[model samples]
Target: MFTTIHRWGNSQAVRLPKGILETASLRENDRVEITAEYDRIIIRKATKKHLTIEERFEGYNGDYRCKEADTGGPVGNEEW
Candidate 1:
């Protein structure tokens, strides 16, 4: 398919058809990495790095203390 590049808010944008997006397994608002190689423009889905629990909290002082909150008696049939 042929598409024309148009000016969009000071940026050049090209509209990708739904078929192309579906084939690429991409959805609206999905992040993509665009690169220019020679005379070709490559568009690929961005990969996200999943961090582990320890990696998420690398720097922690552990100075936090939990305090019980006084929530008024339950209004429903719940065991305390």
Candidate 2:
């Protein structure tokens, strides 16, 4: 399979075929890491890091209070 590199605005872009994407388990809007090694370009899916709840709120001072907000009443067919 072959593809042509086209000028997209200010950068060069290559359109990967559907088969290639499927083989790599890649989807549209997926994050990828691109690197150039010698004369070849490599593309790989970016790994996501999962943070625990404690890690996510490492610097919190616990000063938040939950409040009920008035939504101007229900408009359509609400059982409330």
Candidate 3:
């Protein structure tokens, strides 16, 4: 089947039919890759790797410290 191409804002677009999207296993926010070979264009889903929080932070150790409170009286006309 063929679909009409239309101008969207400053770009060209073609609305994908629901059946086509479903058959391609594509969903909302899914990443896709498009490539052109000679006179034909091909679009496919992008391969992505999902990592857990722990997997993302598998690194060396680091140190962090909090500042100590100053108990001195106000030295300026700043609001308390």
Q: On a 0 to 1 TM-score scale, where does candidate 2 land against the true structure?
A: 0.62
Per-residue accuracy of model 3 over 1-80 as CA lDDT, tens digit each:
89998999999888899899999999877878889999977878987666688878778355657799998887789649
Two-way lDDT contest, 1 vs 3, winner: 1
C-alpha lDDT score of every prediction, in listed order: 0.92, 0.93, 0.84
- Cα TM-score of candidate 3: 0.58
Ranking by TM-score: 2, 1, 3
lDDT-based ranking:
2, 1, 3
- The backbone clash count of each candidate, in order, is 0, 0, 0
Candidate 1 regions exceeding 4 Å error are 49-80
Off by over 4 Å in 2: 49-80
Checking candidate 2 for backbone clashes, the offending pairs are: none
Displacement of residue 30 (Cα, Å) in model 3 is 0.6
C-alpha RMSD values across all candidates: 14.9, 14.0, 10.9
lDDT of 1 by residue, 1-80 (tens): 99999999989999999999999999999888899999999999989656799988888778889999998888778767
Per-residue CA lDDT of model 2 for 1-80, tens digit only, reads 98999999999999999999999999999888899999999999989666799999999998999999887877889758
In terms of lDDT, model 2 sits at 0.93
Clashing pairs in 1: none
In angstroms, the error of model 2 at 59 is 2.9
- Structural RMSD, model 3: 10.9
